[model samples]
Target: MQKISTCLWFENQAEEAAKFYVSVFGDSRILDVSRFGEGGPGQAGQVITVEFEIEGRKFMALNGGAPANFTEAVSFVVDCSDQAEVDRYWSALTDGGAESMCGWLKDRYGVSWQIVPSVLGSLIGGPDPEGAQRAMQAMLGMQKLDIAALQTAYDG
Candidate 1:
């Protein structure tokens, strides 16, 4: 059992969101589900929470039954090794979502996610200040990160 897992508050999309997330990531599955009992706050047999794990991180989707709006203040970051990986995640996550500045995006469920490349850190924090700034500039203009473009900026 992992300690300190994340819990997502939802109006009523606990099961749906958990299943969607499980399908999106590899090495992930539904862990457990707790349902409402008779004469409860929710309908009997309705899912109260759906626990799941994605890439080793555990998450609980809760049917809090309120207007659960997610903000960009907290977001999950998906680090990709290359353009293909980045594109894959971007496509899946942004299918019904909106794109934001840089690599930030709001998924269909209103969850913010940052799909970034693994090399972004090095490119934007390299020893060469000019190169780093160039990389940062390149990243600022990109919705989906392009490793080649960032590398070119850093190399310049």
Candidate 2:
């Protein structure tokens, strides 16, 4: 059992969201689900919380009603090893979602995510300041990160 894990708040969609997440991530599954009891905040037997894992990382989802919502302040970052990996996650996550600049997107559930190449850190933090700046500039203009373009800017 993990000592600590992330929890997502939803409006009576914890089960749906957890299932969707499990389907999206190849290595994921639902661990457990707890339902509301009699006289609880929610209707009896209603889904209250769900426990799941994504790529080995455990996450909990709470059906805390419609009050709580997701925002851009907190986002999950998917570090992709290659363009193919980046495309896979980007396409799946943005299917019914909106795309934002700099490899950011808001999923149908309003959760923000960043699908970026693992090399981004290296290119933007390299010793060459000018190259790093170019890479940064290239990333700023991209919705979904382009590894080739970033490399070109880094090498320019």
Candidate 3:
């Protein structure tokens, strides 16, 4: 078992969200699920917790109900090898969610995600400070990162 797995709190969509996430990521699976007990806080037989993994990273979803909600404070970052990968994740994640600047998005379940190109770090933190600034400016103008545009900006 991996130590220090992330746990997400949901109103009651733990299982549903887990299934959706498993479908989105190319490498992911549902490890296990635990249902509520007769005297538990949640409805009996309802999903209490869902254990899953995405690209080998472990996560748990809890049906904590009301009060507990998702915010932009925390988000999952997906590193894409190219524009295709970025497009895929961006489309999947933003189907029923809102888009934010700089490749950030809120999924249907209100979870924030960052769909970033693998080269983003190098482009934005490269040795050439001017190129890095250009890349940063390009990224700031996009919702879903355009890898080609970023590359152009970096090369400028």
lDDT of 1 by residue, 1-156 (tens): 787999999999899999989998899999999998998888999999999999999999999998779999999999898899999999999988898878999999999999999999999999999999999999999998889999999999
Candidate 2 Cα misplacement greater than 4 A, ranges: none
Off by over 4 Å in 1: none
lDDT of each: 0.94, 0.93, 0.92
- State the lDDT of candidate 2 residue by residue for 1-156, as single tens digits: 779899999988899999988988888999999998998877899999999999999999999876687899999999899999999989888888899999999988889999989999989888899999999999999999999999999999
| Clash pairs for candidate 1 | none
Q: What is the lDDT of residue 12 in candidate 3?
A: 83
lDDT for 13 in candidate 2 is: 85
Q: What are the clash counts of all predictions, listed in order?
A: 0, 0, 0
Winner on lDDT (1 vs 3): 1
Instruction: Name the lDDT of candidate 3.
Output: 0.92
Q: What value of lDDT does candidate 1 attain over all alpha carbons? A: 0.94
Q: What is the lDDT of candidate 2?
A: 0.93
Model 1 vs. true fold: TM: 0.97
Residue pairs in collision within model 2? none
